[model samples]
Target: MSSITSFNDSLMSHQNFVLIGIPGMQEKNSWVAFPLFVLYALTLLGNITILYAIKIDPSLHEPMYFFLCMLACSDLGLCISTMPTMLGVYWFDSGEIPFNACISQMFFIHILQAIESGILVAMAFDRFIAIRGPLRYRSLLSNSVIAKIGIAILSRGLCVCFPFPFLIKRLPFCRSNVLSHSYCLHQDAMKLACADTRVNVLYGLIAVMCTVLLDALVILVSYILILKTVLSIASRKECLKALNTCVAHISAILIFYVPMIGITVVHRYGKHLPPIVHMLMANIFVTVPPLLNPIVYSVKTQQIRQRICSILHLKRTRG
Candidate 1:
């Protein structure tokens, strides 16, 4: 307790921090750069391709496609947010970040993450309306309505993440400011601060519950309802068609959440495991979603597939 108070008292002098990038790699840390750079590049290309397909295809201007565009945009934001610092650490061994920059990075990364979670919920809602209320879905999710939802999504993320940096800023990082990873995570940064971080931890927990977990629950319930609705339909072909449409989205959601949850569990409870397990989980949690999201959407979504193929000058043959 005294140590906490002493650390809080010394909050004003912190100027920068060191991030321990891929500490488990040690000698192999340099090799990790190759994969990181490849993921960064592939993610950029995939998301850019998705955005371009949406932009050029007027058929994709509807709410579903628009939400996809938003998802791609958010993925791009997530990628760009950490790319520089991550690369610096892996490639150049430059792990030091100024205090303000670290704060900025954390704010953007978390906000983008929050935005992605909200977008997934919104997308699930879209699928729900499409499957359960096909006749009304169009009218229910008009252009104005979709636009409002997008705005609300952005606002929710911004409001949720706004206080995190400020909360961390108040607590002086008196202990070594060296973070466990190449990224700036709220909990990671908080632990570096020697203050009584009970407030930060509680708020962080509340934030996760309100955002990611809530979104996941809603999605699960939505799918259950959708399945029930589809099963009740008499036409087998129609049921299959509806499920097919959902497959791509389900894959994308799983890709994002599985590793994210793994990392979260590892971060909180897997302290007993090797450090490399945590690092690898952390690496894939962020990288895999962006890397696979566009690819899944492009391959599994017929419209997107056709558009992408056309962009590559591939000719489609009529069967």
Candidate 2:
């Protein structure tokens, strides 16, 4: 307890923080940057292609594709948020970040995450409408309605995440200003504070519960209702077709949430585990969803697949 008080007494507002990249793999970071760069580039390419395809293809201008475009936009933002710090760490060995810049990065990262979760929930509702009431789907999700939904998603993300940086700013940091991951995360930044963080902790918990957890629950319920609708179809072939439409979305949800949950568990309870384990999970959580979502959609979504194929001039052979 005395030690804690001593640290608190010495606490001063730090102007800069150092990001130690890949705790034990400093020597191999230069080499590691190659694959990471490739993955980032591919993610950019995939998401851009999805957006472009939807933009040019008139047949793709529907509510489903609009939500997809929103998802791609969020994925692109997530990539941009993490790219500089991550690549800088591995490629140039530059990891020092100013306090305000760190706060900005942390804000964008969390807000984009919240936005993406909301997008998934929106997409699930789109699917539920499409399956549950195909006739009313178009009328229900009209252009104005979709626009309003998009606005609400953005507004909710902004409102929920805007307080995070301020919360961190009010706390004094006396502990070593080194973060666990290469990029700024709210939890990671909060852990270095020398003051009482109960408010921060409680607020963070409320934010996660309201956004991510609530969004996941909504998605799950949407799918369960969708499954009931699919099962009610009279023909096996029709049921299979309806279920297939959801495969890409289900894959996206799994990739995003599974890694997110894994990283959370590792951060909270995996102190005895290797530092490398934590590093890898953080990287995967941010990187994989953007990299794989487009791929999954391209393969599972037929119109998108054909549009992409035509754009690439790849001839599809009839089976």
Candidate 3:
């Protein structure tokens, strides 16, 4: 017990944390970096293409495309936020992050995550409006209203995540300063603090409940209502057509949420699992959605796919 106490005391003023690439597998980080870099590169390319497609085509300036653009932007932000630390850990063997930098990193990550959740809800709402009342959808989700919704999503994320850094700053990290992943997470950092963290834990739960859980519940309800509306259509073909519009959004939701839920479940209940399992899930939760979102949308969204193909064809002809 004395040894433990002394160890804790020694780290009471820790200002740097060493982030991990893959737990107990540090020697293989260079190999791990190859796949991760590919994913990051693809994420950047796909999302940029999506944005460019939307920008060059005025026909795609509707509410749906606007929300899609927002989703792409948020995914890009998530990738950019984690890229530095992630590459540092894998490529350069440089995992040490200053206290302030770690706090800021966590803050940006959580805020962007919250924004992404809100954007998903917004997309669901867009689908609901389109299917429920196509005539009114134009007036209801006009450019002004869409802009306001975007601002609200950003504001809400900022407000909800604003306190996280401060809350984490107040806690005393008096133990091992090695984070379990390439990036800093609020919950991961909170666990190393020597002081009481009830407030941090409670607030973190509340934030998740308010942002992620609430957004998911809202999306589910929107889809339920959309389903009812679709069912009322007498024609089977019409019902299928209505459902087709939602395929991309549903794919995006599953991509983001499944890995997220996997990470949560693994962290909470998979104590017996190998540490690599937990690390893999954490990395996937951060990386996979961004990599896959654009591809899913491109393949499932006809307009985006056509625009991208034409753009590629034009470049080829020019070359």
Backbone atom clashes (below 3 Å) for every candidate: 0, 0, 0
lDDT of 2 at 49: 98
Q: Write the per-residue lDDT of candidate 2 for residues 10-101, one digit (tens) a residue.
A: 56436787776779778888987889999999999999999999999989999999999999999999999998789999899998888999
Model 3 over residues 1-319: C-alpha lDDT tens digits? Answer: 9998897666754779889987887988999888888888999999999999999999999999999999999999999999868988999889899989999999999999999999999999999999999999999999999999999999999999999999998987877898888999998899888899999989989999999899999999999999999999999999999999999999999998999889888877888999899789989999999999999999998999999999999999999
Q: Could you say which candidate leads in TM-score? A: 3
| Model 2 regions more than 4 Å off | 1-13, 314-319
What's the true lDDT of residue 211 in model 1? 90
Candidates 1 and 3: which is better by lDDT?
3
RMSD per model, one decimal? 3.9, 3.6, 2.0
Reference-based TM-score of each model: 0.93, 0.94, 0.96
Deviation from native of the Cα of residue 266 in model 1, angstroms: 0.8
> Poorest 10 consecutive residues of model 3 by lDDT?
6-15
**How many backbone clashes are present in model 2?**
0
Q: How far off is residue 288 in model 2, in Å?
A: 0.7
- How many Å off is the CA of 173 in candidate 2? 0.9
- Compared with the true structure, all predictions reach lDDT values of 0.88, 0.92, 0.92
